[model samples]
Target: MTPPRDVAVVAYARTDHQGPAEGLSEAETLLPVLHEVLDRAGLAPGEADFTCSGSSDYLAGRPFSFTLTLDAVGAWPPIAESHVEMDGAWALYEAWVKILTGRADTALVYAHGKPSAGDPRDVLTRTLDPYYLAPLWPEPASLAALQARALADAGHTAGPDPAADPLAGPPAVADGAAAVVLAAGDAARRMCGRPAWIRGADHRVEPHALGLRDLTDSPSTRLAAERAGAFRAPVDTAELHVPFAAQDVVLRRALRLDDTVTVNPSGAAAGPLMVAGLIRLGEAAARIHRGASDRALAHATSGPCLQHNLVAVLEGDA
Candidate 1:
């Protein structure tokens, strides 16, 4: 069977790097970027054929946080929309699927989270299996530490003191929001001056049980990257959602990205958050627009110990 035609990311936007974005509701934090993305795409809110968003109610200390953000979209006439309790990158996947199915020619995707509202480390316990794991209070960091140790023992990582531990180093939590506008073929041409054609995109999930997984290699990420067709096509840059420093190294190996590929020029100063993965997409698109890179790969991760992952390969026209 012939592969589906490529879709394009026409525009993207993100909020200022800030801590705990207090005093503003989720709607408030998301509204400006929503409008900015529309404007960047040269389209109106009502023009999108479909809309999807990613967010977590637990982070907001309340449920249905995404429903309120609908007000920002002015959904009076109603629109095709969906929500994921995952990151915005997953929402981008949903949007891409919508376009691929011939159901929608244009889509708006957004994601937000307030990691500052609660003790992020403590709250991460909810991601664990409630019946068997939650009671143990295995925070996300500790689980990551287990994986790091496993990698170290397997020689996938360095450092003589394998038992010294890695998670005790530092935390990478932050707060932010991000949005992107996508369109297909002619619709994409009308939306932006320079659209980054999405050559391929794919995501994968590993078993929830930590013991059942291999820590030395992220099979899920490798599977997703392979499905994304990035390895088949040349990639000039890779914007990966690596919150922890060590995970960056792990992902590089999993994706088979060499030093020639530009990685995370944003650095720790940018303060990545839940929307970081989506921001990577936006950053790649920006590189295309600026002619800084011709082809790029963007990746996002979800769940504890990188149990879930997504990858998208993007390219530009000369």
Candidate 2:
């Protein structure tokens, strides 16, 4: 079998995070970021062999929400395009595979969402089992709190129970957009001074039924990290897409990250619905690009109670 092709993140860009933009369209917010990431990679529109995006129609209240986002990419020439109804990290995964398969040398991955446009908890419910879970309309944080409680019960709780404060203030809400450029082999080295080569990337999910999963643990994350080779070595930095404080604890144990690893200097505040995950990838890759970290981990999670998890291990030239 051929050895896996080396894929690296060459450039990353994201908009300033903030509370709801009074009336900004998603396309308006993403256009500049699209141009900037491509420019950083020294590419023009449609220059990449493939382009993919991650987003959701539920957040936009319109079917085919991703098509409008295409306006930001200028698909006039009809590039090899695709989209995922997921966070941008998943979109990056698609592009990574495209390069690894030798079908493309370079690809652009982007994602945007305006969770501020509506009540996010209400929207996130759609990710649950519609037949049984969606009807409950349980907030994602509430599910996380259950995990917090379970951790405390299982003696896995590292510190104060994050669930103890149900009356605590809600999480910070922000609209966000992000883009990343990926290249394979020599192209990656040329596009970046210290390219963050993807040593391993994998995502896994547990059973959809809430009762079928162990709320106190993230086996899927652990398995994904194992498959992604996260435990093969220590990472100097970790950018985690933590939806709740308790989820952070769950992720730490799964990734086996110790204090030596710096976590989320880029701020993991959940910006919009799908953008935060991609931002995690961009943040980790940026650190490697700048020589700030020789090795790093970028994690993204979706679904209720960490039902789905993605792990990517990155390292700079040795």
Choose the strongest candidate by TM-score: 2
- Candidate 1, residue 238: Cα displacement in angstroms equals 0.4
The top-ranked prediction according to lDDT is 2
Q: Compared with the true structure, what per-residue lDDT tens digits does model 2 show for residues 48-138?
A: 9999999989888889988997888988988999999999999999999989899999999999988888888787787788898889888
CA lDDT of each prediction against the hidden true structure? 0.80, 0.86
Backbone clashes in each candidate structure, one number apiece?
0, 0
Model 1, CA-based lDDT? 0.80
Off by over 4 Å in 1: 1-3, 158-166, 169-172, 269-273
lDDT score for residue 121 of model 1: 74
Alpha-carbon TM-score of each model against the true structure: 0.92, 0.95
Model 2: colliding residue pairs: none
lDDT of 1 by residue, 1-318 (tens): 112976899998988855777687777888999999999898887789999998888876787767988988878788889998888888998898889989999999998887887887788888788888888998766777777767767776642243334566546566778899999998887777778988888889999887788777799899888888888977988888865555765788899888698886555412444687788888888888777889999888888877898989888877
